[model samples]
Target: MTVAERKDISNYLNRPYNIIIKSISDESGDYYVARVLEFNGCVATGETREEAYQAIYEVLEGFIEDMLEDGEAIPEPISDDEYSGNLRVRMPKSLHRDLSQAAKLEGVSLNQYLINKLSK
Candidate 1:
C-alpha cells in the first residue's frame, strides 16, 4: 500500500467506531466475540473479553485496508447529531390496530407507547 493509503487507514482506525463484545459459552469453553458495528463482517474472537476487545482493532485495521485497496467507500462512525430520533416502521394493519388500542388503554399516544416498550 502507498504511504497515503496507510495514513488514511491510521486516521480511520483512530475514529470512535462502536465495538460490541458478547460472551458465548459452548461445549469447548467460554469465549468472547467482538464486532465493529460500522464495518459489517468485521469480527474477532478470543478466550477473554479483553483479548476480544484488542483483537477487534486488528480486524478493523484489516477491514479498512481491504476497503481502501478495493476503492470502496469506508463508512465513518455515525455521530450523535446524525440521528433525528424518527423511525418509520411498516407493520400489519392488525398489529397496528392492536398497538393503538393498547396505547389508548395505557393513556399514552402510540408514539409514546412504542418508546416505552423499546426502552425496556
Candidate 2:
C-alpha cells in the first residue's frame, strides 16, 4: 500500500522504541542531545530535556515521512509485545551462593550487582 493509504502518521509513530538522550554541558552552557537509536544520523538538541525530546520526536517523524516519500525502507518501531527484558540463567548452586554473598556485602540486589559487574 502507498504511504498515504497505510495509516495515520501519528498513529504509526506512536510505539515503543529506543531513544537515547544524553546531557552535554560545558563552560559555555548546557545542552540536551537526543536521537532515535535506529534512525541512523537523525538527531536533535535543545536546552532542556523536554525540548530535546520534542525536537528529536519531530525529527524522527520527518525522517520517517521523507523515507516513505522517497520509497526508502524504514525499520519498524520496537513491538510492544516483544522484548520483555527478562532472562533466566542457570549456574552452579555454589556460584549462586557466592553471588548472593557478594551482593549482600555490596548492599545491592543480586541482579543489580550482577549488572554492574557485567557492565564493567
Candidate 3:
C-alpha cells in the first residue's frame, strides 16, 4: 500500500469500534484458501473473507446500538500493540479539513500523520 492508503487504514484501525482482523489460509498444492480465524465477538463472518470483514462492521454497529437501547454499559476500546496511550479529541471542521489536506500531502491519513507527529 502507498503511504496515503496506509494512513487511511491506520485511521480506521484506530477507531474504538474497529478491530484488527486476522485471517489464516490453508495452502493447497495449487491454491490457497483463507478464512477469518479470529475477531471480536462484535463482528460476524461470511463465506468469503472480504464479505466477512465488510459485514462485521455493520454487525458491530448494530450490536452497539442495541446495547445502548437496552441500557447496557458500553464497552471499552481495544488497543493495538504499537500504541501505548489513548486520547480522544474533537476539532472544528475547518481545522479538520486543513489537517486532512496536510496529511494527504505527506502521503498519510489524518490520524496517522497526527500520531506520527505527536510521537516525535
Candidate 4:
C-alpha cells in the first residue's frame, strides 16, 4: 500500500469510534467481547476487559485496512454534539391519550412525564 493509503487508515484509526465491551460466560468460562459499532462484524474477545479492548483495536486496524483496499467507504464516528436530544416517536392514539391523562394526573407535562418514564 502507498504511504498515502497508510496515512488515511491511520487517520481513521485515530478517530473516536464507539466500542462496546460486554462480559459473557459460557461453558468456555467468563470472558469479555469487544466490538466497534461502526464496523459491522468487527468483533474480538479475550479473558479480560483490557485484553478484549486491545484485541478489538487490533481487529479494527485490519478491518479498516481491508475496507480501504476494497475501496469501501469508511464510516466516521458520530459525536454526541450531533444529536439534538429531541426524539420524535410515533405511538398509537390510544396510548398517547393514556399518557396524556396519566401525566395530567401526576401534574406534569406530557413531555416531562415521558422523559421521567424513559429515564427509569
User: 2 or 3, which is superior by lDDT?
Assistant: 2
Backbone clashes, each candidate: 0, 0, 0, 0
Model 3 lDDT tens row, 6-118 = 56445544466544455545453222122222234564655566666777766655555565557766555544774867778899999989999999999988889999989
lDDT per residue for candidate 2 within 64-116, as digits (tens), equals 78887798877777565777868799999999999999999999999999989
Which stretches of model 2 miss by more than 4 angstroms?
Answer: 1-7, 79-116
For candidate 2, the lDDT comes to 0.84
lDDT of 2 at 108: 100
In TM-score terms, candidate 1 sits at 0.84
TM-score, model 4 to reference: 0.89
Task: Output the number of the TM-score-best candidate.
Answer: 4
lDDT of 4: 0.95
List lDDT for all candidates, in order: 0.94, 0.84, 0.60, 0.95
| Best by the lDDT measure | 4
Candidate 1 per-residue lDDT, tens place, 10-82, comes to 9999999989999999997899999998888999999999999999999999988888889999997978889
At residue 99, give the lDDT of candidate 3.
91
